[model samples]
Target: MAISSAGYEGTVDEPQWSDLLANGGGRQYAVADAASWKVTAGTADREVRIAVGRGYGYGVRDVSDTVVSLTLPAPSSGSRYDLIVAHRDWQANVTTFTRIAGSSARSIPTRVQTPGTIDDQPIALVRVTAGQTQVTEIVDLRVVNGSLAFDELVLQYLNRLGTKVRIGVTEWDRDVDSVGNPVWNRTDVTPDTGWVEATRNGGWAFQYCQFRRVGAVIFYRIAAERTQGWGAGDNLAIIPAGFAPDVATYVASSSSRGQGREFVFQTNGSVDTAIASSGATNVTLIGSYVAPR
Candidate 1:
């Protein structure tokens, strides 16, 4: 008797089990026939054995009252496969599975069952890492339609060395002396005043200056006016704290009556102006510096 490509078929009276046995493609024997197989299949236990010419094969057995195990033949170095197991008990709390490859055995997390859940699930094993884990890119920014928005994003590190640094944008007005200390007599002007020590001498009035900082660098733009007319005299402006110039020799550009002069930073963090021509009402200064932390 032979089993054809279409498979075996027979009536009850005719029978096909003998035909399957006679063909000898595979065989079923008592479990006791395999001396190395340690499983109790009871008195009626039988096992199907097949000769795999290549690749691998699996043997599953109910080992004991509380244990079931699946065995696989040893595989070659580059070979890989996926294995799946199902549990009929939905209330089981098993959250891990064991894998034995070559001489190495490891316990891996089972994905199907999570804590506080009672459901049978499927698990996927991605990759086994043996060294450092790395990622090339995490995010990309783009505009959708005509709008762009993000719920949360971190632009800077929280800590530098052991100190905390912050970044911000602000707009304010204040009056100060040569070292950047605020003078309480200043008023907030309509168009935004950036002056330090603004004062009036008889008919002439002057607005000191203003400065802004980014990181540890500071940039300043200041202006003063001779309300009635320009005059010849020295005016002083204080540099704010945290933005003082590194040296007194630092020079800033000062212009009056269409002519440019130089203002210098004094050792006390003040800027001393050059003589202003009589009737000259506009005096301005501009400069930048790297401030100390």
Candidate 2:
């Protein structure tokens, strides 16, 4: 027999996957099956929408003859978030994944929370039925507050499970924090040894005020060479990661590496660099803003 996220994967016949949505006066949603859900062509359960409010529900789009689509609601900004998706049937879990290649089958429920919630959480769980083109889709999506208030947004399809589909939120990098924020730049070079302290001299730009990893060892140095003609450390040494030191926030200024002289840093993982001072020449104090690789 065939199977879908709406059903179970193995001999149990049926599986039940659900979520306990904490609607901060909004709706909630979760994708049970993801394999059969297709977005490109020749599929079903193609899209999704998650709703948040006093009552939580989801909207699914049936695409092609085999694809199904759905959507869920976004949680309130700056609020605690928790979501879980699991297989409905326990017995079928094994048979559900037996035939799928490059797939992992497990009875363990997949739990997701803000990054800090758990220690090394797997992105999502997968299961496939034997001898079937089983696919799964899970989605996690959020729409920032706009003029017109809406409860939900559509998420891009992720992967497939048994005969159904799965979708989840796509991870992204975004600019945050106001300029003029003081920060210290530190590559993995020397933890507290090298330091580059800088502030928003002015300019609207996405500065990488933090880094987490950089290869085996990140090499960074905070340098301020005293210009020969300029007296008493006249020329600035390094411009912080995201600042155009010599320009106003709204005005176009010289590049961060102007005149072929600037501070250099390397990072890969979580690192923090802040705007230290409005104007300070010569001395470049560097420190570990965030952990380095």
RMSD of each: 27.7, 18.4
Candidate 1's TM-score reads 0.28
Model 1 over residues 1-293: C-alpha lDDT tens digits? 11011111223122333332333223111111122122221212121112111110011111112322333333333332322222212244222222223222222233233312432211111122232122111121111111111111111111112221111221122245588664323121223224333222334344546666664456677666655543333545666654566665545345645245555665566666555545555656676765543
Find the number of clashing residue pairs for candidate 1: 13
Of candidate 2, the 10-residue stretch with the lowest lDDT total is: 94-103
Output the lDDT of residue 152, model 1. Answer: 13
Query: Residue 218 of model 1: what lDDT?
Result: 63
